[model samples]
Target: MATFSTRYSRLRDNVEEEPNSSAFDEIIMKQEQIIRDQDEDLELVGRSVNTLKHMSTKIGDELNEQAVMLDDLGNEMDTVDSKLNNVMKKIAKLTHMDDGKCTCSQT
Candidate 1:
């Protein structure tokens, strides 16, 4: 009876002192879940960054087109100014001629 009691006590101690592997597995699963959430957030941020870059490029293109149109308008305005100056000069000459200061010798 004493031998049996000692043997049972030793076996109980060995089984009771075993490491809890389920605790480690639970910790590992929690860490994996956190990593998956972080990955999803990173993907969403990457997509938002790409969208902003595309919009910026589109705005730049539109500004460039507007700049070209402004240049064309400036050139047309210069041509109109030259034509107006020529017309003014002709009108001044005609007005002076009508003022009886005509330089024609066959009057």
Candidate 2:
């Protein structure tokens, strides 16, 4: 029992004399640098997300404007088609009256 107690006291004294090992301090410093690098990477990712959001908004606005313009163009095409149909009807009426006959008199 005395030998065991002496060995325990010697171990305790050695542990107390060297509280902070050089290897342990280096490991802690490396961990802190890693944490700082991770924080910077997260900030950059957040900025990239914001930039993408802004670009998406701009693209959506442009697409909406294009849709409106296409709608206006469709309306204009309908108007032109109606006008052409009217002109065709008038031509058909005149052709029916003529019936391949010349009604001009010699003066």
Candidate 3:
């Protein structure tokens, strides 16, 4: 009868230890899942950053192109201004007489 009691007590202790071990395993599984989720989030963020960088680089390239075009336009405007000044000087010379008087004399 004493041997039977000892076996029963050992079985009870074994059953109690099983729940504790199971709880530890559950905690480890949850921790591993959390780590995996965090790794995925970080990868997504890295991809987003790369996309933003590409867009910003494209924008910068477009801005440079626009700046070059603006400089070309400015040079063209200067040429036009020079031509206009020449035309004005010619008109002024035609209107002026050698005596610095008006060509349409008063009767």
Predictions: Cα RMSD each: 12.8, 8.3, 11.9
> Model 3 off-target regions past 4 Å?
1-19, 100-107
The CA lDDT of each predicted structure is 0.89, 0.87, 0.89
- Which residue runs of candidate 2 sit more than 4 Å off their true CA positions? 1-19, 102-107
The window of 10 residues in a row where model 1 has the poorest summed lDDT is 1-10
Give, for candidate 2, the lowest lDDT window spanning 10 residues: 1-10
In candidate 1 the C-alpha lDDT for residue 77 amounts to: 100
Question: lDDT tens digits, residues 5-87, model 3?
Answer: 44443444556456587789999999999999999999999999999999999999999999999999999999999999999
- Across 37-76, the per-residue lDDT of candidate 2 in tens digits comes to 9999999999999999999999999999999999999999
Models 1 onward score TM values of: 0.64, 0.67, 0.67
lDDT over C-alpha atoms for residue 69 of model 1 = 100
